[model samples]
Target: MTIALRRRLLAEFTGTALLVTAVVGSGIMATTLSPDDVGLQLLENSVATAFALGALILIFGPVSGAHLNPVVSVADWFLGRSAGTGLTGRDLAGYVAAQTLGAIGGSILANLMFDLAAVDFAAKDRAAGHLWLGEVVATTGLILLIFALARSGRAPVAPAAVGAYIGAAYWFTSSTSFANPAVTIGRAFTDTFAGISPASVPGFVAAQLVGLAVGICLLTALHPDAGTAADQVVAPTGERDPVLGHRP
Candidate 1:
């Protein structure tokens, strides 16, 4: 209801929309430029994802905290880290809705742009089991990286860290590290070379969330940052974020 809350929601929507656009647009391009090799297309996709995320963060860091993922938001909430740019229940709900819708719309746009909406869910280069492992490892790495950067007060430049983690995960993880659920949903709309089947969505989301939980547990084992004062408040809008903020 407040102006700050509105801005925060708008920030969330804007961040999500931009991320989806980059993802879907790149996939469309990859389909054309690298039609013969899917691996090459994926490589292009990872690079684009990293740059898009990094740029978006640099552009939007001062607004809405750039929390484009539900897990990040939930993490912030649980840690009492709500980046009090002025958030309320209604605002949070609107942000979540806008993010999800932005993702879907992004897919549609990509599909329209290059006929990149054709999803061949049956294109079996790898088994579903392997894909599941990819999701697990990719998501875990992302969360752990986020946790480490946030704990270190390096989240102000988190875009770079987040981008590199995702880009690297693409090479290492089986599923190309589609860790963000919002992103996954948006990709689904395209049904293009980057699209995942409706059937894979739920499983991917579940597994990614689980991986994040595992990372959080791991965070507890490490000691708090030595530089920060004992009473340091890395929550809300103090210095950085712990549960939600990304790495940089």
Candidate 2:
């Protein structure tokens, strides 16, 4: 692997790890602080997640576009294939692997931090048709928001916008917006407030995939040339040409 690609992969791994850490860790803390009120626990968890997500994006946006989510990476690859501007097939594979591993590690780390078993598999059963629908809606909206910002020359605001949308989706969506497949898998490692049961992973992933398809279709209809701006999804990276302001 080239030095640049390796750096990008490292960024992906670390960024995703930290993002998951924020999620799982904050959830643990929230439950401790608000043990009696599920509502307050969710409020704290969602707020922390939103802030952490935006900060992580700013910290790693220059590297690997801070995708931090498999669905986002896949969407970037598919959307940019024709334009030759987003992740290549090899990069996509590497990113997904890194993200998944990072997520698991983050979950383990969160458990360890809370004096809990490091590898406790989550027992939170989230299987239900209504929850599946929520996942679909959440993922679809996430995809649309990220790409819309890119396509509209509003990429700079993505950190805040994306974060805010997720924060809001937490209350609005039935599934609390676990729109990321890697995150879902990671959350399965903990039985905490933020975790999901492993048995429900396949269904959530399938719903997310469906959401991706729907989001892509809507994005294309709204911005017929959206592919040309695929590299800007989430945010522009350091990989772009310094002179021309885009990938060459």
Candidate 3:
């Protein structure tokens, strides 16, 4: 593999590990550490989620593009954002695998910390218009937030925006912002406060994908350059990518 590709993979692995650890680890802590206060637990989870993601972006935004969520990648990919140094099937395959493993690691750690057994599998809570709409709206907002952030030369905080979106979505949206397919799947392996049911995975993922598509369309209209596939298509070597600049 080329040095660039190796760097990308390394970034992915490290980012995934941190992302999941923050997510799951915080959840475990919230439950056991502050179960008495529901609001405090949620707050802890939200803050941890935000910082964990933010730190990851700061750590690997340059090397791997810091796309911890596959939905973000898929949205960009479909929008023709993979013009130059974009993901090939090989890159995506490795990314998905790494992300999944990282998520599992997070979930397992959370389980160990919290002594979680199994989930009630709240499928019914997420199977209708409200649920789907929540996904669409939440993900639309999330993707837009990220795309706009990238466009505005603020890739450093991409993780925080993403993390904050998810953290806030837990309360604001009906679906709790399962903004990522890999994350949704990984959450299934653990029977904990963060676990989702396997049965509900299809609807959640589908809704998230729809949200991404809609977000892309909206972004395409708002930012014609990204839509036309002319900007932010590849990692920058000499300078920042036009859409997501290359600066500290």
**TM-score attained by model 3:** 0.80
Query: Best-fitting candidate, measured by TM-score?
Result: 2
Instruction: Give one digit per residue, the lDDT tens place, for model 2 in 188-240.
Output: 99998888889999999999899989988998898777878877868788655
Span of ten consecutive residues with least summed lDDT in model 3? 230-239
Off by over 4 Å in 1: 1-3, 81-92, 115-127, 223-248
> RMSD of model 3, in Å?
4.7
Clashes of 3: 1
Which 10-residue window in model 1 sums to the lowest lDDT?
A: 227-236
Q: Estimate each model's TM-score.
A: 0.79, 0.95, 0.80
Residues 1-248, model 1: lDDT tens digits? 11266666676777887888888789778878999998899988889988998787766655666767765554444443233422345655776787787677666665666754333232323237777778878876765566566667766657787778878888888788888778877776655667776767878888778876765566556633321311111121323345667421
True-structure lDDT of candidate 1: 0.65
lDDT of each: 0.65, 0.90, 0.68
Error of 1 at 204 (Å): 0.5
